[model samples]
Target: ILIGEKRFRQQSEDPRTSPSHQPEAGITPSPSPRPRSPDDLEEGEVEEVCEICTPPSDVLVVEGQVVEPFSTDHAQRLIGQIMVLNAQIDRMQEQIDSMRYRLDSMQQEMKNMIDVLGRI
Candidate 1:
């Protein structure tokens, strides 16, 4: 009884264990990381960005852009393209994962079939 009560107390304290952890009735989960905004980087480029943390107010300096304000619209468009390309890469990754799963299943099935045939 003590153990059960302790477990119940711990679970209630844990936000993840509570009923609220489930989505509130009608609240749908956001879509998968697919369909990202233009600001997202391309697939492998995520690895290249420096992880250095900076203060929110820190100003970035770019030496050689033709326009003032650095033509952020161009940057957005390029980033948009990169985002779409990244989605494609993610989709391809899922495809590869699925292929691997299927390959594993097939190999297992083939082995089972071979064993059964040998028994026969």
Candidate 2:
């Protein structure tokens, strides 16, 4: 079933108003619910399409390799690196701005000198 269909069905039936939710209806035993693997997921579950193919395939393996969870220290180190890179970028931008101002001042002075020479 599509993800939208499952969501619609869930929304249509309000658990509070349903007879199943009522205590007098008696607890209905559910069917054997087994854990679903990545292979079991439908096309709708994975939004992204394959690079080789235009449409997404049903047999898409979302995650191939098991990755280790990131620790607090690892995240902190990444943030530190980002901060250092940002500082470098800011310094480069300031240098560029300074160079532009110097160029503009030189151009203005040259124009003033040309105007003075024209008057002679």
> What's the TM-score of every candidate structure?
0.41, 0.46
lDDT of 2 by residue, 4-85 (tens): 1111122124444454333332222233334355677876675322122111211235677887899999999999999999
Model 1 per-residue lDDT tens digits across residues 72-110: 798999999999999999999999999999999999999
Give lDDT per model, in order. 0.56, 0.58
Q: Against the correct fold, how does model 2 do in TM-score?
A: 0.46
- Runs off by more than 4 Å, candidate 2: 1-63
Regions of model 1 farther than 4 Å from truth? 1-70
Error of 2 at 112 (Å): 0.7
RMSD each, Å:
24.5, 16.5
In model 1, where is the ten-residue run with the lowest total lDDT? 1-10
RMSD of 1: 24.5
Report residue 13 deviation for candidate 1 (angstroms): 91
